[model samples]
Target chain A: DAGITQSPRHKVTETGTPVTLRCHQTENHRYMYWYRQDPGHGLRLIHYSYGVKDTDKGEVSDGYSVSRSKTEDFLLTLESATSSQTSVYFCAIRPQVYSGNTIYFGEGSWLTVV
Target chain B: DQQVKQNSPSLSVQEGRISILNCDYTNSMFDYFLWYKKYPAEGPTFLISISSIKDKNEDGRFTVFLNKSAKHLSLHIVPSQPGDSAVYFCAASSPGAGSYQLTFGKGTKLSVIP
Candidate 1:
């Protein structure tokens, strides 16, 4: 286990509401990522952090934002949730020790926007 | 445009048979490939990975084959068991800064039928 934990495993909210998902890791990895999984689109990167307070946009990052204030916590926020933004969000971490480009994922957060 | 593609949405294999999941990529810069297995309501777990320099990597009953020339990869599961049923995702990444971010293909759902 990578010791990754994601909060708000399931949620339903009205459109235009704000939602924040939290990902906490026990292993102090330097890299953390947020991704959304949709039926036909698979998993798309939303944002990633290489270190505390350092972040960058991924392939699909228009409506989402992320923050990594500490080594173990990464937060993803939907400024204004929309129906199209409904998806299963996943948090992943890459261990610095491993030479291979493999990242471990946490249990996903399921969000439904109506 | 999708950088990676998994054309097959679903596949079924009899128990003890071999299950092959194929993936193709459009980006030649992707040098590292990975496969992830995800069960319903859970996060995707890392399965196996291969570097661009190698054509194949194996772990027990699971093997991943890469064809750099064709920009394709396949995951082979030998003696498939019912427990192997899950969504398999193919992901790739290039080398350099931000290389930890992976581009994923739409997943292929695998069902190992008894």
Candidate 2:
């Protein structure tokens, strides 16, 4: 409903393979973030971008990487995916800057590594 | 250490009753708190939020109460319906750090029985 879309909504990949997930938004929001959800972990941030080409690592950025080339597109890359990395990934955007606006999340992408 | 925590893993409430969910935070810097609801196969949606300056904020049947002294927050849903059953997550952010730095709790599943 927020005009956010995540590609490859469901995918099963083998271990040691490379995978990338794309997030596209039509709202033109400046801040975009990638988060992973696990059973015991609510949501852990992997990476975030404040503006095009500006990215920062989050608390759980060990094996993941992200890139933002345009205002509407943010990409997350998992190089040599591991079984431990299997989880549901979500992309979110903050509606405004310097305000207490709520962040909207896109339908999650489920990834499985075997 | 986990900054945000939701002690209860699940809660059950009868229809038309009240459902209360609790969250706690360890960081004193957190000034903004948010509650999100997630149904199966979809992303978590923003439900309500409150700032540290206020003790309570209400929106329709949903109310969020903040106890700054105790570093705790709770969400109440009156006249709970079956549609209200879902996983609820509590998130906290420091206003100074902005919204992208939100820390989320593990979440509590709510079941509204008819």
- RMSD values for the candidates in order, in angstroms, are 1.1, 1.2
- Native contact fraction, candidates in order: 0.84, 0.64
Measured against the true structure, the TM-scores of the candidates, in listed sequence, are 0.97, 0.97
Off by over 4 Å in 1: B97-99
The residue-by-residue lDDT of candidate 1 on A1-114, one tens digit each, is 878989989999999999999999987899999999999999998999999999999988999888888999999999999999989999999998975889988899999999
Give fnat for candidate 1: 0.84
Docking class of 2: medium
Given the true complex, what DockQ would model 1 score? 0.85
Task: Give model 2's share of reference contacts.
Answer: 0.64
Tens digits of per-residue lDDT, candidate 2, B7-114, equal 999999999999999999999999889999999999999999999999999999999999999999999999899999999999998856643578999999999999
